[model samples]
Target: MKPVSLYNDIASTSYPGRGIVIGKSADGSKAVIAYFIMGRSENSRNRVFAETEDGIKTQAFDPSKLVDPSLIIYSPVRVLGNKTIVTNGDQTDTVYDLMNEGQTFEQSLTTREFEPDGPNYTPRISGIVECENGNMNYAMSILKSADGNPDCCERYTFTYDKPINGLGRFIHTYMSDGNPLPSFEGEPTLVEIGNDDIDTFAEKIWNSLNEDNKVSLFVRYIDIASNKAESRIINKNK
Candidate 1:
C-alpha cells in the first residue's frame, strides 16, 4: 500500500464539512474518536453541540433563527455499551436502534443513503468504535451519490480491526469547498493523534478547523482496559 499522507493539520483545508477521526492515542492506552461539523450557510452555522444522556446532539444556537431542522439538527453521538456511534446525520439513531435489535454496523447502514441536498447530495458519513475484551477496533462508512446521479446511491465501509497507536483515519462530508460541493472519495485519510490528553487534542482540532466555517467539535478518549471514557466538546457559537 502506498504511504497514506498524514493530515497533521486540518486547517490546511478551507472546508472539510463534517468529519470523523478514529484511532489509538499516542501512549497506546486509549482509543481516540473525534467528530466535527462546518457550514457555509446561515442556517447551517446557527447550531451547537449539546451533551445528551448517552451522547451528544446538535441544537439550534438560536431557535428563532433556525430556518429548517430537516437536515441540520440531530443526534451526532450515542453510546450503547462498548460501542460508541457517531455520524453526520440522523443515521446515528438508525445504527443505535438496529444495534439494539442485534444488527451489525454495515447491516444497519444498508437501509440508509446519502443526503437529499442536491446538487451537492452531501454524503452521509458514519463511524463506530467498538471496545471489546480490552481491545479497540473501529469501522467507518460513507454513503454518497453515484457519479452525482441522485438516482443511484453508492455505499462504502472500511473496517480497522487493529488501530495503530498515534494514528487515525479522517473522513469528511465534502472533498472541499465548491459551488456544487464534491463528495469525499477513496478511503479515509490517515492522521496523527499526538496528545494523550483529550482536552489538548480536542482544542488542537478545533483550532485547526477554518474559523469562519467551523461550527462544533466533539472528542472522546476511551480507556481500552477499563472501558472508561473521557470527552470534550467545543461549539464555535458558544
Candidate 2:
C-alpha cells in the first residue's frame, strides 16, 4: 500500500461537504467516529444536530424557514447492537433495517444509489463501526453518479479491520466547491486522529470547516473494551 497523506487540519480546505471519519484514537483505546455537514443553500444551512435515543438526527434550526425536508433532514447516526451506522442521507435507516435482518453493510447499500438531486447528484456516503469481542472494525461506502450521468450509478466500498491508531479515513459528498458540485473522487482520504479528547477534536473539525457554510458536527469515541462511548456535538445554528 502507498503511504497515505495525513490530513491534520480540515480547515485547510474551503469545502469538503458532508463527511464521515472512522478510526482509532491516538491512545489506542477508543474507536473514533465523526460526521459533519456543510451547505451553500439556506435550506441546507438551517439545521442542527439533535441527539436521539440511539444516535443523532438533523432538524431545521428554524422550522418556519425549512423549505424542503426531503433531502436535508434525516437521521445521520444510529446504533444497532454493537454496530454504529452513519450516513450522509436516509441510507442510514436502510443499513439499519438490513442489519436487523442479518444482512451485511455492503449488501444493504447495494440497493441504494446517489441522491436524486440533479446537476450535482450528490453522492451518498455511509459508514459502519462495529465493536465486538473486545475489538473494533469499520467500513465506508460511497454511491455516486458515473461521470455526472444521472442514469448511471457508481458504488465503492472500503473496509478496514483493526484500523491503525491515530489514523482515519474521510469520505465526503463533494471533492470541493463548484458551480455544479463535483462528486468526491477516488478513495477516501487518510486523516490523523489526535488525542482522545472528544471536545478538542470535535471543535477542531467544526472550526476547520468553512465558517459560513458549516452547519453541525457530531463526534464519538467508543471504548473498545467496555463498549462505552463519549460524544460531542457542535451546531452553528445553536
Clashes of each: 0, 0
- Candidate 1 lDDT over 1-238, as tens digits, reads 3324334447767888999988898778899989999989999999999999878999999999999999999999999999999999999999999999999999999999999998999999999999988789999999999968999999999999978778889899888788799899999988777655888788778888898999999998999989898888899897
The local distance difference test score of each candidate is 0.90, 0.89
Task: State in Å the error of residue 148, model 2.
Answer: 0.7
lDDT of 2 by residue, 1-238 (tens): 4324334446656678899989888778899999999988999999999999888999999999999899999999999999999999899999999989999999999999999998999999999999998888999999999978988999999999988878888888887788788899988888878674888788777767888899999999999998898888899986
Could you estimate the TM-score for every candidate?
0.96, 0.96
Deviation (Å) of 55 in candidate 2: 0.7
Worst 10 residues of 1 by lDDT: 1-10
- Against the true structure, candidate 2 has what lDDT? 0.89
